[model samples]
Target: MKTKITLNKYLLVSLLLPVLLFSCKKFGDVNIDPTKSSNLNPVNQLVFTQLRFAGDVTINERTSIIMTMPMVQQISGAYYNRYGSTYIKNKQYMSELWEIGYPNDVLNIADAVERTQSDPLKTNLNAMCRIMKVYIFARMTDLYGDIPYSEAGKAYATGIVHPKFDAQKDIYDDFFKELKEAGNSLNTSKDAVGQELFYHGDISKWKKFANSLRLRLAMRLVKVDPEKAKAEVQDAYNSGLFTDNTDICKVDYNNITNGYAEIRGNGVSVGINQYVDDGRPRVCNTLINEMKQTNDPRLQYIARAYWTNPDRLSDRLDVTDQVKAQVGLLGVDAGHYNYDNFLGAINIDYPGRGTISVPNGGQKAQLADFLVRSDAPFFHLTYAEVEFLLAEATVRWNLNLGGNAKTLYEKGLEAACTQLSLFPNGPVLTSTQIQNFKQDNQLAPGKELQTIDNQIWVALLMNAPEAYANWRRTGYPALIPAITAESTTTTIPRRFEYPLSEREQNAANIEKALTALGGKDDWTGRVWWDKK
Candidate 1:
């Protein structure tokens, strides 16, 4: 029964055993004219490091819901925090893609690809690198609508410094194709590639990740291109996508050597601390009220309750602006109700709302802590998410997608709860706790998709970019306007505004994209996929 496909894909590295002992060494430096060409390992190292950052920081844990404005520390500016300013910053981040970022990060994969071609047996590494590049760029295009894709990552030799933006629909189609080809090409027999970063060189796991990523992309296109989405999902399912444990494609971050903390820690690179509210980003009233109403146990794990004063609760009306201030002066450091005790809380000078403290670090610290060793897996794609995806797809089958969304939704929720338990002394919701959540939050008739998606959103907290993107695709959770919320943009930011740097440097190409996308390049304009 072990066909060539299964054998080549799954058992190759496992069967090879000793032959899989691959290592990177610093060989002789090739000194060319003037400049000495150091070992290529350094470039490879940078390629790996940047991939981790691209996934963790940019697309995943953005503060879509509970974000602050004019955040403490001058550099603590995270535009994803509030409404108006957030929109402006998104515009800034968008424009820089072609001019600054595309050259810097996305193009590095081409280097990886070139390097891999030299080692005939190690060709799989080249494929994996290209696959990861496609993943990162897909996220970029999804967030910002059209972006420099086909022409991106080519500034070094091509002299085509100004890359034009590709439409979102086109980008998604390319991503889906790239993922399928990459998944097929991940032959474990050739040699395990990429320094065991995410799965310790486990090609099977990597393959699973490729398929799962395909599934996610397929799910994304459901609203716009249902037939294509259905075909892709079925293809992945028939091809045996990720069906094992959630730990298969987990990313790693050691506490000191390399991890989210190292990047977020105070150092010269990071010139300020944006972790206001005692190193914990304060919870938005919108999310807090909703969770409280649902009696969701995930609340305790996601965020900690600030020390409540008996006086403040009763005198809600009498409380002046001064009354609600940072509690560091009150000796609130580490406890169940303090900032330090919060699961992902950081450490720095704590400032209250509307107040900005300029610490000597970047907003890295203030941003929510990412998954790492002993905390949880840096989840690539989870079995639970797949189940939810199936739930949605099945419903689209005239309720024939062949599964109950409710049962699958609960399973996914339970899996998330189980995954959260990996954290030290993480909260454990009892059977009664689970029952209470289900009983109170059941979906009304004909609203199964909405209900499943809402739960998915909650499970994906701290995983904001996924939630945000999925929200756009499905429009679930039905987020209401925040109280006193000031957003000139639509209810949800359809896509990021193009980065300002692109406007000045890559004016010609930028203008081409603008013209292609009608007269304006505003964040409010919807992508082709989001068309009504």
Candidate 2:
């Protein structure tokens, strides 16, 4: 029964395929200004490239659930098909982003770069393409460890069906360099030759984005390469980065049929207008408890509690009537932990304790619209994130950044609060409320590093990949080990294993990569930057 109602994480792309085809159809057969069209010209090519960026960067609802959300503990479930319990061995889930991301997003950017390289007027377009390309490749390498960067997505011209994996360090070096050069090359006077998806053709905003990404990419090297990390912090700080949310890399769904919008708007998105709520996964307890402990207002943004007990479907309260009573359950393997454990975890209150729960007869809280809303802006980077990075940079390397760690930490929380307000309908954190949040969640003057890292983890709720990377780097948030950890006899995975399809088709390169990676390609293998 392949009904639309039963569609899950895997079917999202299948639904979008027809939309991709539909996108190619001519509008009224009049060519619709071929130079400014979505195909066969520079505008169209950049549009496609930007659309691809929207998809792979967690804007698409599918990967947001099955990949980043669960891995980072922002969302989870004990249900049969959710990501919480099945993450480590779910090779198909691990592989989907790679399969779709590289070919569609990376290759399109490459095409745009080629098409605009020689045009002096298209410098902004070409530079944006390069930065977007680096952003995509950075995500790829960060998640999967070493990846095909030098020759990836080049089957058309280079015919490199099996691109060899570049070393992660080398890939990161190139990414930083590309961002620096592209940020400098962006001509503020020369606007994009087309409809710019993120910042709307504002070249200054694009430069801010590039420099912000530099801060992000450099911060990843803090533990592994201190010298390089310090240098990057200095470089990025001097490059004139984002001071507010306006410059954050936000993907607007203005053109619905393009990149992330079409993919996430499909039948499988739980936030879809007609989506069924019967089997949707819930927000995880790890995040809920953290928010509850601080009396955080953002809980209203992330979760919607039940009006009546979810266990009683006959008398089930309309979701519309529910108040914001958040009850989050810790993630455990499906069928292994029972209803009793759930009830026990939820049926308690914490007064000034680190973890707190609001009981509701063992039911879990569904993710709020601030998360699942189809039109919610897909955030690629934020001013809060940069502030967090600067906070850490100041503390760790004693960098000469203007602000101290505490000020930057508070600013990060403020920006995160402001960012959530952008969601269509959510709890509003007013100026007073924001000030109270900062007051309540103040860092102990001595433990600045762990304190700042914990706040960063809380700030990065819907952002999965970056959160996971930070977890690997700093190891704050101190989550309980997975139930599967004892049986599998391993800690949480470090990197997603290379897809099995590569093993079958590109065996030679796969072998070389595996051998370079200490003779295994499973989750336990660390990336070059994860030496800590």
lDDT of each structure? Answer: 0.50, 0.66
Which tens-of-lDDT digit does each residue in 1-532 have in candidate 1?
A: 1111222232223222212112223554344211112234422433343433323232222322222111111111222344322233344434433333354456555555555656767667766776777766765676667778887755543656777777777888888787778778877788754443555456777677777788788887877788988898887766566663544344432222222223221111121122333333333333444566777876544433232212111211211122223222111111012222333322333344333332222211222222221223345567768767777776676443335766666666666666665443446667787777777777567887887776676665444546667777787767543322344543445666676766877788778678645768876676666655
TM-scores for the candidates = 0.71, 0.81
Estimate, for each residue in 1-532, the C-alpha lDDT of model 2 and write its tens digit.
1111222332344334324422543455564532222444555545555544544333344455555656666665534224433444667767866887776776666666776789887888888888888988887788888888888866554567778888898999998899999999988678554365677678888889999999989988978898999999899999988998877886643212233435423212332222233345566667777778887777765665433333322333323222224323232223132232445334333334434344433355656544554445567788888898898899887777768877888889899888887666656689998899889877776778887887788777666677888888888777665545323424566787788898898888778778756998877788889885
TM-score, cand. 2 vs. native: 0.81
Which regions of candidate 1 fall more than 4 Å away from where they truly are?
Answer: 1-39, 42-51, 54-80, 83-90, 93-100, 117-119, 254-273, 278-280, 307-377, 398-402, 430-432, 435-444, 483-487
lDDT (0-100) at residue 437 of candidate 2?
Answer: 88
Pairing residues by index, what is the TM-score of model 1? 0.71
The runs of at least 3 residues in candidate 2 whose Cα sits more than 4 Å from the true structure, single-residue gaps closed, are: 1-39, 56-62, 78-88, 254-261, 264-278, 307-363, 485-489
Q: Evaluate model 2: give its lDDT.
A: 0.66
